[model samples]
Target chain A: MPKTIEEINAKIKAGKAVVVNAEEVIGIVREKGIARSAVDIDVVTTGTFAPMCSSGIYFNIGHSKPRIKLEAARTYLNDVPAYSGFAAIDIMLGATALPESDPRNKIHPGDFNYGGGHVIEELVSGKDVCLSAATYGTDCYPRKKLETWINIRDLNDAVLYNFRNAYQNYNVAVNVSDKTIYTYLGILKPRMGNAVYCCAGQLSPLLNDPWYKTIGIGTRVFLGGGSGYIAWPGTQFNPSVPRTEAGIPKRGAATLSLIGDLKNMQPRWLRGVSMQGYGVSLSVGVGIPIPVLNEEILAHTAVTDDDIPATIIDYSRDYPQNLPDVLGEVTYAQLRSGRIRFNNRDIPTASLSSYSRALEIANILKEWMNQGAFLLSQPVTPLPGIESGLAFKPLNYRPVERNNSS
Target chain B: MKVSRKIVLHFPARLVEEAIAYRLVKEYNLQFNILKASIIPDSEGFIVLELTGEQEDYDRGVRFLTKIGVNIEALSQNVVRNEDKCTHCGACLTVCPTGAFEIEPGTRRVLFMHDRCIACSMCLKACPPRAMELHF
Candidate 1:
């Protein structure tokens, strides 16, 4: 007995829907079989909590006393530079943006203590942030310099619009060279001393709906502990990547562009991260609910860590050089076991993504739906699938020819 | 009752030239292994080391060092993890030389054993949220 979004919503409205998290669905499917579980389960919630670098927030800081034209001005939020090219008093700040005083990697493994991510976190936490802008004076708007403290409450509109986030799959980073390398995946010790992989595996939303069966544009999700929407297919979205028999991508593939109200977010779910050598980034919590429309969708949600394989890549060599060669392959089960066997060496494995936090998020979303406070929303349009022939292309570094002969 | 513990010693400028560690060896009959040290002429210095001696002798030796203006404190007291700040991401698990951090079985929660930590300070940099803090 297949279900529909309309049927699921009716059940949710009447407080009769059966909602389970991704972790619980695995056991349910094993105990009741896919056919029976599909009829029993109405929704399966998934979650992920990890550093998402390609995220930013745009906010309209209302207006100044003298109405300075901020569109043509230099803007900063708590010492970190922000983009003010949009409209008057509107500024955008990226998670990775750094202040001018940041030493960067000059001092090996620089301590990026504070940056745009911290500013975002502080704003969401209800802390006052310093906003300063300097612009060339205009006839209509004479003010050129403005400095003030702004809070999320004072802002007219603040939106968290991430261009790319919630990666479906990623590489297990390791360093085979003699020197340690600091990367966004965390520090990779020399001679493959440690392996760092980031992903929630089965609890990840995209992994539960491989091939974009239930998740798509306009899909509602729990973002930063609040309701959000999938704005579009994330940047570097490559559906043409090779996949397993179950349709799970073996490498970094697929992502989501998310949008939500910044004022409604929580400090716990939206954390500011300072990656020792690798600047700054935001750790966002995202959870999506997959309406059990059919047995196939229910079976996909049952995929566990053992069923998903991740490719191991050497960050010291191949990753920096952009080479496609992979060291080997390992399953999420091996990663979670604390140690993985690679080239006859037992290397310790760690995750930048928090499995416990992911589970908590999944549980929270499940509670929301089970209590009939949250309702499932159907996507207005489907994302590009494997048949879309979409390819993630690299930039071609070519010099522009000068027409000096003319 | 022989006891072994890691402690840090701070020496003033006047005591920098004195054979302080030698006094521990000869007078107190204590064995010391220096883990890390920073000393400069005519300046205050500090040393991190493991001291082994009899329980009574160890107490007396520490009292003697304190009497001589040498500040003594446990090495483990310098390192601490902020519970509220930690998201339990497990980033400190691999970089930790002493394997002080572990993910609990079943619950997947990251557990930090302070007794197992050697104060290597690798976790302070490896932790994304800066959860591991150093008081020194």
Candidate 2:
């Protein structure tokens, strides 16, 4: 029997079963979407059937020895993981075996109608059920399928309930679409603190993949508009920091020293010609994940507005009980020493000399994001380096005049 | 280095006499020549064209055909598999052009050996149960 929801909750609370977090939910949803979409696209573009046989035949002789064999050979040319797994014949015999019937007796070659009209039914129902259960069980909780199922069910229930509360509080319809979430927040519920907090925990599978590595940095940066801003890259850094300098502040770099060092860090990927002008900065002394950590700091700073200077100070000092308070102290000391500012506002303006360099940087960053950071250390013989080199020419970026309407 | 090129055209048999094939030859300004133009029966209606020209010109001819909305696909000589609903009765043994299918001894099961299949499709037309197919 399946365990009750209450029992599952108790197990979770007791730490006997792991609870599914927002990140895991988001990852699962993303992977499912990707797999389904890829399957559809491959079918449409290639016009190829999935390798698994859709039809099978089974012949049975009533009451005597029943023999079952698949009509078609199972082929694995299509690379479908679902069809390649184990399958079995679940035979349901209608009547009892006759005493005169011999189990090993083969039906005569010309006998079409014999043995009290036997019925043969082929079963295909368990294919999808078994495949789905196995994939989910192994991927999420290799050791415990029931525990993972319970945790995911609980998490999904919580998210749905939270979304419902958001809908009621914001005066929006229950069917509000995800595409409209950002717009809704911006217009109808910009100041709703609970709505924002609720959304932060809602795992969007369409937006996140589990296999995709993500680094959440919680750090403070100056937005330069008198308000601080938070930037969450969602995934890990495109260009990961080198391992040697990972978590260590560069010597004598005062402004960044306040930010905790990210030891053994690496950029997520390399940039190509298409993307330019995107890099992240981190303080040497903080222990936050570079992506979300930086964003959280920005969020806190943005709330304070221009009253606060663009300093790398301990934003969590007031809430001394906060876990990040220890790192906040180091950040504050670095800010006092003028080691880190809120914004790196030194981006060069568009000009002949700077345009090319900016474009080059943008391309490098773009390639990095698309290809991932794992390929960063590989030889870049086919592509040009981020800096100017012997083979490739520097990229050019010139601003075009905008169309002015009457 | 120079390389010779050839283009294989596929179309409905009824359209073989049309001016499209001749016009393609003149447009490329090539030493165009048709090797064999034939119609495949029972394919609804389709034609095949084999042309020889310079590699560059052959590529240009393909693009021209594509622009004119001609359905062109690479022609590969392979066994084609066709399936029709079968009633489990073996009756095509007599008319089979190739002895590709035979009944298993004592089991009455029909077995197909693809190697002996000539893709003649005679069994496809002969089978009363309509289970035989030409697979490529």
Candidate 3:
């Protein structure tokens, strides 16, 4: 029977509905095609657990005794800069933020043991971390300095409000330089020695909903072992990135801004990562359920790793800005198979992302849906499409003057 | 019987000129795959090798090396890395399920905890320098 949104919600509320993951949706499509799969399956859960560098956590630490207006305050959570630009106790800690203890990437090559992500992980694991802050004392508010230990419980409100979480697609990283490079890409061997990529391809939420028709504000998602929502379009959400005929991005494209409760998170999915020369980052595990409302939705949900091809780039060069030429394209299946052959050259592929954890999160979301603890939400507004291009703002006097007038 | 073991064969400066591997194969009917070797003349030399042979022949080869004062020792780790070659790129961190490969903070160096490793062998090929090796 073709199920309506209301009908599906009713079944879910009553504890009766059949939910298949993105991986399972393919077999259903092959057997019954998109038409029947849409009617039969209530929901198609998609998951991706990758090391998302453009991430952070926001915290409302409540009023301290004597409540100082801490405008110039400098805050550090376990030595990681948790700089909150706001007037009071709200603080934001970026995932890639490194501790001030390290002067530079000077520790040793590639052994960055701790950073903001590690602090977040430790807090999520119920471990206490030192919280210290200093600010000039005001006439009314006397306290100038504060130092204490805090865990997830001490905060009045601790939310993982990541400005960027799930990337729709990402590039494979390789080194073409003379020396091996340590990057957030997890150490690139020069001369394209080893290739590493992160993403679950077809199983990713944005891929299944390529146009972001079902992923937007209020679209409930499973984030790092907890429920979250797509708060806004992520930073560098270039829907304008060139795409293949299959609608997959030829380069990096759409991304999402996610928000979830830090208290509800688990340490297993929120892992701390460090690159030798690079700083630290958090590996966030996210699972989003895509409801199969029609044949289009079902068809996209059935997309496989082989069907999606993301680009491989040379990380040895200055990236995102001064990016080098694209090496070539390869499918997720080929990359995940531990080897990829492109441009007549055989390259071994490694992933900073975890496919196992992605699967585990998908299963958890499926169970959450089954138990009626979670519900799929229709997007209030669909995101921009391929026609919407993104361009850099040129720092020219005339062009800038023109923009300022407008 | 076929056997594979990582044994370090040490040679004094005087024995550096000798063809020890050729002699072992010819005398004991054993096979050797040299994993690492640096036999500099007039200096203490060592060769890390995987020697495979019949049970009796393997025992006899060990005795022969000992008699020649070529110190032979076994490795506790099957999957070992050459520190000189390890650039600590952290490529192995992606495949490790047990969190065995850790990057120390402040220094940003890769720390390997052999106990937590499940021996998936994913790092063997992912490593760029070929620093990672598996004896077993």
Candidate 4:
């Protein structure tokens, strides 16, 4: 029988629960089998530290004297534009948001010293940011403009409300074109000499719970070194991708929208990243606890690097127009070997994800659970696992027919 | 043995106009590539070149130069990366000709093998955080 949430909580408080990280539990289950391990282990922890481009933070800055209820406003944080989509002083700054001075669209990489990512890291590190905003004067609150410096302490609700984070799987990028291409995939060597993949592999949360059995709404997590929770199903949560017999997606699939506090986060786990020739992104550290509700959950945690494999893609083929070709499928163990063979030669690989940081986050969560400071919460709702995929309708521009009488 | 070495060839002030490069290849059968040369205009002269040739011919070429009072010294400048400042972003990985920078499987930290480094100094510019430094 599966252990109840109350039982797990009481066991944690009494310091009698068996909690092991996903990587460690895999070894234990391999020796004892899932049937035996499920009855023994109470929870499994999974972690990852990767650059998240679709991330942002919202802050409610303190009001300046005279209460600027300005009709229109523009603002910037560390040279990057912070969208003024909210009331008076609340703003949301995205990781990839660039300065107005930059002339880059989505295709070209802009050469800039700092971006939104740096501003977020500076705030987490307790550094002040140069905040500048201009507004048109209003009748009730007549403040035309304001420029000052502010830190995390000066904000009321400095919450990291990232819309998307933690991909289930990612593509291994390489350059087949003659010219070196700069992308979020990092700089790829010409003719596929080097390939880069970003993921914690065995330690990734979504990979651990591939089917979303035990991970869902209300699940408490370690986000950016602070305690956080999953807000909703992440944008682009495509569960319709082809899967292995183990149910893990062979390509990029599920993602999680996360919300956390800026005050509790640490600068060490939150670093600013700039992909040369590309845009800026934030390195987010996240860890989620998977409750061992039954033997099924144990089976998921038992999955290791050898059990998970992803295809190597030639990114030079404009994804939709030409479609990326699968060079070959290799297990995570082989990918982590530092080199993999494709065609006739061995190509060196680099990871955009930090394996060391992932391990650190996992261990930190283990200590928290063992000390009874953290408790497991049953998911309020299970994630969608529909077999069908979502689609968009095409535009129609045909002329109206009037039986040739008009 | 066939070998390549970065050497500085010191020339006497009077030999500044001598065709030493042509004589080394034609007379001594030495294969050389000039890396740097600053024959001071009408003054003391010197040239830096990577010399490669057969063991006997290399010996003969060195002897010929030394007999004429031309000094030679191996270049010693190298690339150094500060572990404390390196963020291990791996931007320097692609530009390295000798594969000196590699990721450790266990920690995912970029490992710098000084022995494999050729001191090309390409990584010095590729590094975003400016962690790489050239030491002479």
Best by TM-score: 1
State the lDDT of candidate 1 residue by residue for A307-370, as single tens digits.
8999999999899999989999999999999999989999999999999999999999999998
Q: Which candidate model has the greater DockQ, 3 or 4?
A: 4
Worst 10 residues of 2 chain B by lDDT: B82-91
Number of the top-ranking candidate, with DockQ as the measure: 1
Task: Output the number of the lDDT-best candidate.
Answer: 1
Q: Could you give candidate 4's per-residue lDDT for residues B101-127 as a string of tens digits?
A: 887765677889875665668677455
RMSD of each: 4.9, 31.4, 7.2, 7.3
Cα-based TM-score, every candidate:
0.90, 0.16, 0.82, 0.81
Candidate 3, after superposition: displacement of residue A102 in Å?
Answer: 1.1
| lDDT of each residue in A270-346, candidate 2, tens digit only | 00000001111110001111111122211221111011111111212212232212111112122212122223321
Question: How does residue B73 of candidate 1 score in lDDT?
Answer: 81
Q: What share of the true interface contacts does candidate 3 keep?
A: 0.09
Quote the lDDT for A401 in model 2: 86
Give the CAPRI rating of model 2: incorrect
Model 1 misplaced regions, further than 4 Å? A401-406, B1-5, B8-57, B60-77
lDDT of 1 at A106: 94
CAPRI-style class, candidate 1: medium
Q: What's the iRMSD of model 4?
A: 3.0
What value does DockQ give for candidate 4?
Answer: 0.21
Cα lDDT computed for each candidate against the true fold = 0.93, 0.24, 0.76, 0.79
Residue B27, candidate 2: Cα error in Å is: 9.3
